[model samples]
Target: MGKVVVVGDRYTVSLFKLIGTEGLVLDDPLNLETTLIKLKKREDIDLILVANDLYNPVKEKVESLVIEQKKPLVTVIPTPFSQGQPLDVKGLILRALGFG
Candidate 1:
Protein backbone atom coordinates (compact mmCIF):
# COMPACT_ATOMS: atom_id res chain seq x y z
CA MET A 1 0.00 0.00 0.00
CA GLY A 2 1.26 3.42 -0.88
CA LYS A 3 1.53 5.86 1.97
CA VAL A 4 1.45 8.80 -0.40
CA VAL A 5 1.55 9.48 -4.15
CA VAL A 6 2.51 12.83 -5.60
CA VAL A 7 1.61 13.76 -9.20
CA GLY A 8 3.18 16.86 -10.66
CA ASP A 9 5.78 18.42 -12.94
CA ARG A 10 9.50 19.02 -12.47
CA TYR A 11 8.88 22.28 -10.68
CA THR A 12 7.40 20.43 -7.72
CA VAL A 13 10.19 17.87 -7.64
CA SER A 14 12.01 19.39 -4.68
CA LEU A 15 8.93 19.61 -2.55
CA PHE A 16 7.93 16.06 -3.38
CA LYS A 17 11.46 14.86 -2.87
CA LEU A 18 11.30 16.35 0.57
CA ILE A 19 8.06 14.49 1.04
CA GLY A 20 9.70 11.29 -0.21
CA THR A 21 12.72 11.81 1.99
CA GLU A 22 10.41 11.87 4.94
CA GLY A 23 9.49 8.20 4.26
CA LEU A 24 6.97 7.92 1.45
CA VAL A 25 7.77 6.12 -1.80
CA LEU A 26 6.42 8.12 -4.68
CA ASP A 27 5.65 6.75 -8.09
CA ASP A 28 8.20 7.11 -10.86
CA PRO A 29 8.79 10.59 -12.23
CA LEU A 30 7.61 9.88 -15.75
CA ASN A 31 4.75 10.51 -18.10
CA LEU A 32 1.42 11.07 -16.43
CA GLU A 33 -0.16 8.21 -18.34
CA THR A 34 2.18 5.68 -16.82
CA THR A 35 1.65 7.07 -13.35
CA LEU A 36 -2.10 7.06 -13.71
CA ILE A 37 -2.03 3.55 -15.07
CA LYS A 38 0.02 2.38 -12.16
CA LEU A 39 -2.25 4.19 -9.78
CA LYS A 40 -5.24 2.45 -11.31
CA LYS A 41 -3.70 -0.94 -10.75
CA ARG A 42 -2.73 -0.26 -7.17
CA GLU A 43 -5.47 -0.72 -4.63
CA ASP A 44 -3.25 0.45 -1.79
CA ILE A 45 -2.91 4.07 -2.72
CA ASP A 46 -5.06 6.24 -0.47
CA LEU A 47 -3.98 9.74 -1.39
CA ILE A 48 -2.98 11.64 -4.55
CA LEU A 49 -1.07 14.93 -4.69
CA VAL A 50 -1.59 16.80 -7.93
CA ALA A 51 0.28 19.99 -8.71
CA ASN A 52 -1.87 22.86 -9.92
CA ASP A 53 -0.05 23.59 -13.16
CA LEU A 54 0.23 19.99 -14.22
CA TYR A 55 -3.31 19.36 -13.16
CA ASN A 56 -4.58 21.98 -15.58
CA PRO A 57 -2.97 20.26 -18.54
CA VAL A 58 -4.63 16.99 -17.70
CA LYS A 59 -7.56 18.15 -15.64
CA GLU A 60 -10.32 16.60 -17.73
CA LYS A 61 -8.66 13.25 -18.04
CA VAL A 62 -7.60 13.19 -14.42
CA GLU A 63 -11.08 14.12 -13.30
CA SER A 64 -12.46 11.30 -15.37
CA LEU A 65 -10.08 8.85 -13.77
CA VAL A 66 -10.86 10.12 -10.29
CA ILE A 67 -14.53 9.70 -11.02
CA GLU A 68 -14.10 6.19 -12.27
CA GLN A 69 -11.71 5.11 -9.54
CA LYS A 70 -13.33 7.04 -6.70
CA LYS A 71 -10.27 7.59 -4.56
CA PRO A 72 -8.98 10.38 -2.33
CA LEU A 73 -7.18 12.96 -4.50
CA VAL A 74 -5.46 16.03 -3.10
CA THR A 75 -4.54 19.17 -5.04
CA VAL A 76 -1.36 21.03 -4.18
CA ILE A 77 -1.15 24.44 -5.74
CA PRO A 78 2.30 25.87 -6.43
CA THR A 79 3.50 28.81 -4.38
CA PRO A 80 3.11 31.24 -7.25
CA PHE A 81 -0.27 29.89 -8.12
CA SER A 82 -3.59 29.77 -6.27
CA GLN A 83 -2.46 32.56 -3.97
CA GLY A 84 -0.09 30.23 -2.12
CA GLN A 85 -2.80 28.40 -0.25
CA PRO A 86 -3.27 24.68 -0.19
CA LEU A 87 -6.72 23.66 -1.21
CA ASP A 88 -7.75 20.27 0.05
CA VAL A 89 -8.40 18.35 -3.14
CA LYS A 90 -10.05 15.75 -0.97
CA GLY A 91 -13.12 17.94 -1.05
CA LEU A 92 -13.12 18.03 -4.81
CA ILE A 93 -12.56 14.33 -5.00
CA LEU A 94 -15.35 13.76 -2.49
CA ARG A 95 -17.69 15.93 -4.47
CA ALA A 96 -16.85 14.04 -7.61
CA LEU A 97 -17.69 10.82 -5.83
CA GLY A 98 -21.01 12.26 -4.68
CA PHE A 99 -19.96 12.04 -1.05
CA GLY A 100 -19.24 15.72 -0.41
Candidate 2:
Protein backbone atom coordinates (compact mmCIF):
# COMPACT_ATOMS: atom_id res chain seq x y z
CA MET A 1 0.00 0.00 0.00
CA GLY A 2 1.19 3.48 -0.86
CA LYS A 3 0.34 6.95 0.39
CA VAL A 4 -1.84 9.52 -1.34
CA VAL A 5 -0.41 12.92 -2.26
CA VAL A 6 -1.70 16.18 -3.61
CA VAL A 7 0.24 18.76 -5.58
CA GLY A 8 -1.02 22.21 -6.47
CA ASP A 9 -0.85 25.94 -5.79
CA ARG A 10 -0.68 27.46 -2.32
CA TYR A 11 -4.44 27.69 -1.83
CA THR A 12 -5.06 24.12 -2.92
CA VAL A 13 -2.19 22.76 -0.87
CA SER A 14 -3.32 24.66 2.18
CA LEU A 15 -6.87 23.39 1.79
CA PHE A 16 -5.66 19.77 1.58
CA LYS A 17 -3.37 20.25 4.57
CA LEU A 18 -6.26 21.64 6.60
CA ILE A 19 -8.03 18.34 6.02
CA GLY A 20 -4.86 16.49 7.15
CA THR A 21 -3.80 15.40 3.69
CA GLU A 22 -0.18 15.21 2.58
CA GLY A 23 0.61 17.56 -0.30
CA LEU A 24 3.11 19.86 -1.94
CA VAL A 25 2.45 23.53 -2.56
CA LEU A 26 4.08 24.72 -5.75
CA ASP A 27 4.63 28.45 -5.60
CA ASP A 28 6.59 28.70 -8.86
CA PRO A 29 5.82 27.19 -12.22
CA LEU A 30 9.51 26.88 -12.98
CA ASN A 31 9.82 24.20 -10.30
CA LEU A 32 6.87 22.21 -11.60
CA GLU A 33 8.95 19.86 -13.71
CA THR A 34 11.45 19.12 -10.99
CA THR A 35 8.73 18.65 -8.43
CA LEU A 36 6.85 16.23 -10.65
CA ILE A 37 9.99 14.26 -11.40
CA LYS A 38 10.66 13.83 -7.74
CA LEU A 39 7.11 12.75 -7.07
CA LYS A 40 7.22 10.25 -9.92
CA LYS A 41 10.33 8.66 -8.47
CA ARG A 42 8.82 8.24 -5.06
CA GLU A 43 7.74 4.64 -4.49
CA ASP A 44 5.66 5.56 -1.47
CA ILE A 45 3.12 7.63 -3.35
CA ASP A 46 0.27 5.81 -5.11
CA LEU A 47 -2.30 8.50 -5.87
CA ILE A 48 -1.55 12.09 -6.86
CA LEU A 49 -4.24 14.75 -6.92
CA VAL A 50 -3.20 17.74 -9.00
CA ALA A 51 -5.08 21.00 -9.36
CA ASN A 52 -6.62 21.47 -12.83
CA ASP A 53 -4.99 24.87 -13.17
CA LEU A 54 -1.54 23.45 -12.55
CA TYR A 55 -1.98 20.14 -14.38
CA ASN A 56 -2.43 21.70 -17.81
CA PRO A 57 1.10 23.11 -17.87
CA VAL A 58 2.82 19.82 -16.99
CA LYS A 59 0.31 17.42 -18.45
CA GLU A 60 2.64 15.89 -21.03
CA LYS A 61 5.34 15.14 -18.53
CA VAL A 62 2.86 13.68 -16.10
CA GLU A 63 1.35 11.50 -18.79
CA SER A 64 4.73 10.16 -19.77
CA LEU A 65 5.39 9.13 -16.21
CA VAL A 66 2.02 7.45 -16.00
CA ILE A 67 2.61 5.50 -19.18
CA GLU A 68 6.17 4.50 -18.42
CA GLN A 69 6.27 3.92 -14.69
CA LYS A 70 2.59 3.09 -14.10
CA LYS A 71 2.99 3.59 -10.38
CA PRO A 72 1.29 6.74 -9.24
CA LEU A 73 -2.21 7.55 -10.42
CA VAL A 74 -2.55 11.20 -11.28
CA THR A 75 -5.88 12.98 -11.31
CA VAL A 76 -6.82 16.60 -11.94
CA ILE A 77 -9.24 18.29 -9.59
CA PRO A 78 -11.02 21.61 -9.73
CA THR A 79 -9.57 24.36 -7.59
CA PRO A 80 -11.43 25.70 -4.58
CA PHE A 81 -12.16 29.05 -6.22
CA SER A 82 -13.45 27.35 -9.34
CA GLN A 83 -15.56 24.78 -7.48
CA GLY A 84 -18.23 27.32 -6.61
CA GLN A 85 -21.30 25.16 -6.99
CA PRO A 86 -22.41 21.75 -8.13
CA LEU A 87 -24.07 21.45 -11.53
CA ASP A 88 -27.88 21.40 -11.51
CA VAL A 89 -28.68 18.42 -13.72
CA LYS A 90 -32.46 18.81 -13.33
CA GLY A 91 -32.40 22.47 -14.30
CA LEU A 92 -30.22 21.68 -17.30
CA ILE A 93 -32.63 18.99 -18.46
CA LEU A 94 -35.66 21.27 -18.05
CA ARG A 95 -33.95 24.11 -19.93
CA ALA A 96 -33.00 21.73 -22.71
CA LEU A 97 -36.64 20.63 -22.91
CA GLY A 98 -37.87 24.30 -22.95
CA PHE A 99 -39.90 23.66 -19.81
CA GLY A 100 -38.00 25.83 -17.37
Candidate 3:
Protein backbone atom coordinates (compact mmCIF):
# COMPACT_ATOMS: atom_id res chain seq x y z
CA MET A 1 0.00 0.00 0.00
CA GLY A 2 0.93 3.69 -0.22
CA LYS A 3 1.22 6.46 2.30
CA VAL A 4 -2.05 7.45 3.99
CA VAL A 5 -2.61 10.94 5.25
CA VAL A 6 -5.55 11.44 7.64
CA VAL A 7 -6.99 14.92 7.51
CA GLY A 8 -9.23 15.96 10.38
CA ASP A 9 -9.25 16.69 14.11
CA ARG A 10 -7.10 15.02 16.77
CA TYR A 11 -9.59 12.30 17.72
CA THR A 12 -9.75 11.24 14.10
CA VAL A 13 -5.96 10.97 14.11
CA SER A 14 -6.19 8.39 16.88
CA LEU A 15 -8.68 6.34 14.87
CA PHE A 16 -6.36 6.61 11.90
CA LYS A 17 -3.68 4.92 13.95
CA LEU A 18 -6.08 2.05 14.56
CA ILE A 19 -6.60 1.75 10.78
CA GLY A 20 -3.02 0.45 10.54
CA THR A 21 -1.69 2.72 7.87
CA GLU A 22 2.03 2.28 7.33
CA GLY A 23 2.29 5.88 6.23
CA LEU A 24 2.37 9.07 8.21
CA VAL A 25 -0.82 10.61 9.68
CA LEU A 26 -1.03 14.35 9.58
CA ASP A 27 -3.19 16.02 12.27
CA ASP A 28 -4.36 18.95 10.26
CA PRO A 29 -7.41 20.74 11.67
CA LEU A 30 -6.47 24.32 10.95
CA ASN A 31 -3.78 24.58 8.34
CA LEU A 32 -5.53 22.43 5.76
CA GLU A 33 -4.26 24.44 2.80
CA THR A 34 -0.64 24.06 3.83
CA THR A 35 -1.12 20.41 4.66
CA LEU A 36 -2.73 19.75 1.30
CA ILE A 37 -0.05 21.72 -0.46
CA LYS A 38 2.51 19.50 1.19
CA LEU A 39 0.48 16.41 0.39
CA LYS A 40 0.35 17.40 -3.27
CA LYS A 41 4.10 17.68 -3.31
CA ARG A 42 4.56 14.23 -1.81
CA GLU A 43 4.26 11.93 -4.79
CA ASP A 44 4.54 8.97 -2.48
CA ILE A 45 1.20 9.73 -0.83
CA ASP A 46 -1.28 7.41 -2.56
CA LEU A 47 -4.41 7.78 -0.45
CA ILE A 48 -6.20 10.39 1.61
CA LEU A 49 -8.73 9.76 4.42
CA VAL A 50 -10.98 12.67 5.18
CA ALA A 51 -13.03 12.57 8.42
CA ASN A 52 -15.18 15.40 9.57
CA ASP A 53 -18.07 16.13 11.93
CA LEU A 54 -19.97 17.88 9.17
CA TYR A 55 -19.06 18.65 5.59
CA ASN A 56 -15.37 19.07 5.03
CA PRO A 57 -14.60 22.23 3.16
CA VAL A 58 -11.06 21.08 2.57
CA LYS A 59 -12.42 17.99 0.86
CA GLU A 60 -14.19 20.07 -1.75
CA LYS A 61 -11.00 22.00 -2.42
CA VAL A 62 -8.79 18.94 -2.68
CA GLU A 63 -10.98 16.29 -4.35
CA SER A 64 -10.25 17.88 -7.73
CA LEU A 65 -6.62 18.07 -6.84
CA VAL A 66 -6.62 14.39 -5.99
CA ILE A 67 -8.11 13.63 -9.39
CA GLU A 68 -5.72 15.96 -11.17
CA GLN A 69 -2.82 14.44 -9.27
CA LYS A 70 -4.10 10.89 -9.69
CA LYS A 71 -4.47 9.74 -6.10
CA PRO A 72 -7.19 7.75 -4.34
CA LEU A 73 -9.57 9.27 -1.77
CA VAL A 74 -11.48 7.83 1.20
CA THR A 75 -14.14 9.72 3.08
CA VAL A 76 -15.44 8.62 6.47
CA ILE A 77 -17.54 9.71 9.40
CA PRO A 78 -15.61 10.18 12.64
CA THR A 79 -17.70 8.94 15.50
CA PRO A 80 -16.47 10.42 18.75
CA PHE A 81 -16.61 7.22 20.80
CA SER A 82 -16.61 4.41 18.32
CA GLN A 83 -13.01 3.65 17.62
CA GLY A 84 -13.10 -0.13 17.92
CA GLN A 85 -16.41 -0.55 16.12
CA PRO A 86 -16.39 -1.77 12.54
CA LEU A 87 -17.03 0.91 9.97
CA ASP A 88 -19.11 0.14 6.88
CA VAL A 89 -18.42 3.58 5.48
CA LYS A 90 -14.74 2.81 5.62
CA GLY A 91 -15.48 -0.42 3.84
CA LEU A 92 -17.12 1.59 1.09
CA ILE A 93 -13.93 3.55 0.59
CA LEU A 94 -11.76 0.46 0.66
CA ARG A 95 -14.05 -1.25 -1.80
CA ALA A 96 -13.91 1.72 -4.12
CA LEU A 97 -10.12 1.66 -3.94
CA GLY A 98 -10.12 -2.10 -4.55
CA PHE A 99 -8.55 -2.81 -1.20
CA GLY A 100 -11.54 -4.43 0.48
Candidate 4:
Protein backbone atom coordinates (compact mmCIF):
# COMPACT_ATOMS: atom_id res chain seq x y z
CA MET A 1 0.00 0.00 0.00
CA GLY A 2 1.06 3.59 -0.50
CA LYS A 3 1.96 5.82 2.45
CA VAL A 4 0.21 8.74 4.11
CA VAL A 5 1.89 12.10 4.52
CA VAL A 6 1.15 15.16 6.60
CA VAL A 7 2.23 18.63 5.49
CA GLY A 8 1.74 21.31 8.09
CA ASP A 9 3.50 23.19 10.84
CA ARG A 10 6.08 21.55 13.10
CA TYR A 11 3.56 20.61 15.74
CA THR A 12 1.22 19.07 13.20
CA VAL A 13 4.05 17.11 11.63
CA SER A 14 5.25 15.95 15.04
CA LEU A 15 1.81 14.78 16.07
CA PHE A 16 1.34 12.60 12.99
CA LYS A 17 4.92 11.36 13.00
CA LEU A 18 4.35 9.78 16.39
CA ILE A 19 1.67 7.60 14.82
CA GLY A 20 4.11 6.37 12.12
CA THR A 21 2.87 8.63 9.34
CA GLU A 22 5.51 10.51 7.40
CA GLY A 23 5.35 14.31 7.63
CA LEU A 24 6.86 17.49 6.28
CA VAL A 25 7.07 20.74 8.21
CA LEU A 26 5.71 23.59 6.13
CA ASP A 27 5.42 26.88 7.97
CA ASP A 28 5.19 29.17 4.97
CA PRO A 29 1.95 29.75 3.12
CA LEU A 30 3.81 30.98 0.07
CA ASN A 31 5.46 27.59 -0.31
CA LEU A 32 2.32 25.57 0.16
CA GLU A 33 1.53 25.20 -3.54
CA THR A 34 4.98 24.09 -4.48
CA THR A 35 5.12 21.70 -1.56
CA LEU A 36 1.82 20.10 -2.48
CA ILE A 37 2.80 19.75 -6.12
CA LYS A 38 5.98 17.95 -5.12
CA LEU A 39 4.06 15.61 -2.87
CA LYS A 40 1.53 14.86 -5.58
CA LYS A 41 4.31 13.73 -7.89
CA ARG A 42 5.46 11.01 -5.52
CA GLU A 43 4.19 7.54 -6.35
CA ASP A 44 4.70 6.37 -2.79
CA ILE A 45 2.34 8.87 -1.27
CA ASP A 46 -1.37 8.07 -1.34
CA LEU A 47 -2.92 10.59 0.97
CA ILE A 48 -1.94 13.97 2.37
CA LEU A 49 -3.48 15.32 5.57
CA VAL A 50 -2.84 19.05 5.81
CA ALA A 51 -3.46 21.19 8.86
CA ASN A 52 -6.41 23.54 8.48
CA ASP A 53 -4.27 26.62 8.93
CA LEU A 54 -2.14 25.85 5.93
CA TYR A 55 -4.87 24.32 3.84
CA ASN A 56 -7.38 27.10 4.18
CA PRO A 57 -5.34 29.56 2.20
CA VAL A 58 -4.92 27.21 -0.73
CA LYS A 59 -8.21 25.41 -0.53
CA GLU A 60 -9.38 26.22 -4.05
CA LYS A 61 -6.15 25.27 -5.73
CA VAL A 62 -5.79 22.10 -3.69
CA GLU A 63 -9.35 20.99 -4.31
CA SER A 64 -9.03 21.50 -8.05
CA LEU A 65 -5.88 19.42 -8.18
CA VAL A 66 -7.34 16.64 -6.05
CA ILE A 67 -10.55 16.47 -8.03
CA GLU A 68 -8.64 16.27 -11.29
CA GLN A 69 -6.64 13.25 -10.19
CA LYS A 70 -7.49 9.90 -8.67
CA LYS A 71 -4.61 9.43 -6.25
CA PRO A 72 -2.87 11.22 -3.46
CA LEU A 73 -6.07 12.47 -1.92
CA VAL A 74 -5.53 15.68 0.01
CA THR A 75 -7.61 16.43 3.07
CA VAL A 76 -7.73 19.28 5.56
CA ILE A 77 -7.56 18.48 9.24
CA PRO A 78 -8.58 20.86 12.00
CA THR A 79 -5.82 22.44 14.02
CA PRO A 80 -5.87 22.71 17.83
CA PHE A 81 -7.37 26.16 17.58
CA SER A 82 -10.28 24.86 15.52
CA GLN A 83 -10.84 21.63 17.40
CA GLY A 84 -13.22 23.04 19.92
CA GLN A 85 -16.06 23.09 17.40
CA PRO A 86 -17.81 19.88 16.55
CA LEU A 87 -17.05 18.43 13.11
CA ASP A 88 -19.75 17.82 10.59
CA VAL A 89 -18.87 14.20 9.94
CA LYS A 90 -21.79 13.66 7.64
CA GLY A 91 -20.94 16.64 5.49
CA LEU A 92 -17.32 15.58 5.32
CA ILE A 93 -18.31 12.11 4.30
CA LEU A 94 -20.66 13.41 1.68
CA ARG A 95 -18.00 15.67 0.24
CA ALA A 96 -15.46 12.90 0.28
CA LEU A 97 -17.84 10.73 -1.66
CA GLY A 98 -18.62 13.57 -4.08
CA PHE A 99 -22.26 13.48 -3.01
CA GLY A 100 -22.32 16.86 -1.36
Query: What TM-scores do the predictions have?
Result: 0.54, 0.67, 0.59, 0.76
Worst 10 residues of 1 by lDDT: 21-30
Residue 59 CA error for candidate 3 (Å)? 6.3
lDDT score, candidate 1: 0.53
lDDT of 1 by residue, 1-100 (tens): 3445666655455555553511223244335545666765666666666555655666666666655655544434452354566755456445534569
Instruction: Please provide, for model 3 over 18-50, each residue's C-alpha lDDT reduced to its tens digit, 9 standing for 90 to 100.
Output: 766533344544455566567767666667665
Please give, for residues 1-100, the per-residue lDDT of candidate 4 as tens digits. 6777888888868867776789898877667788888988999977777788887787776767656656778887776556567655446534654569
Clashing pairs in 2: none
List lDDT for all candidates, in order: 0.53, 0.67, 0.57, 0.75
Q: Which residue runs of candidate 3 sit more than 4 Å off their true CA positions?
A: 22-30, 53-67, 72-93
The predicted structure with the larger TM-score, 2 or 4, is: 4
Who is ahead in lDDT, 1 or 4? 4
- How far residue 78's Cα lies from its native spot in candidate 4, in Å, is 0.7
| lDDT, model 3, position 74 | 41
Model 4 CA lDDT for position 8? 82
Model 4 alpha-carbon drift over 4 Å, by segment: 83-100
lDDT of 1 at 49: 61
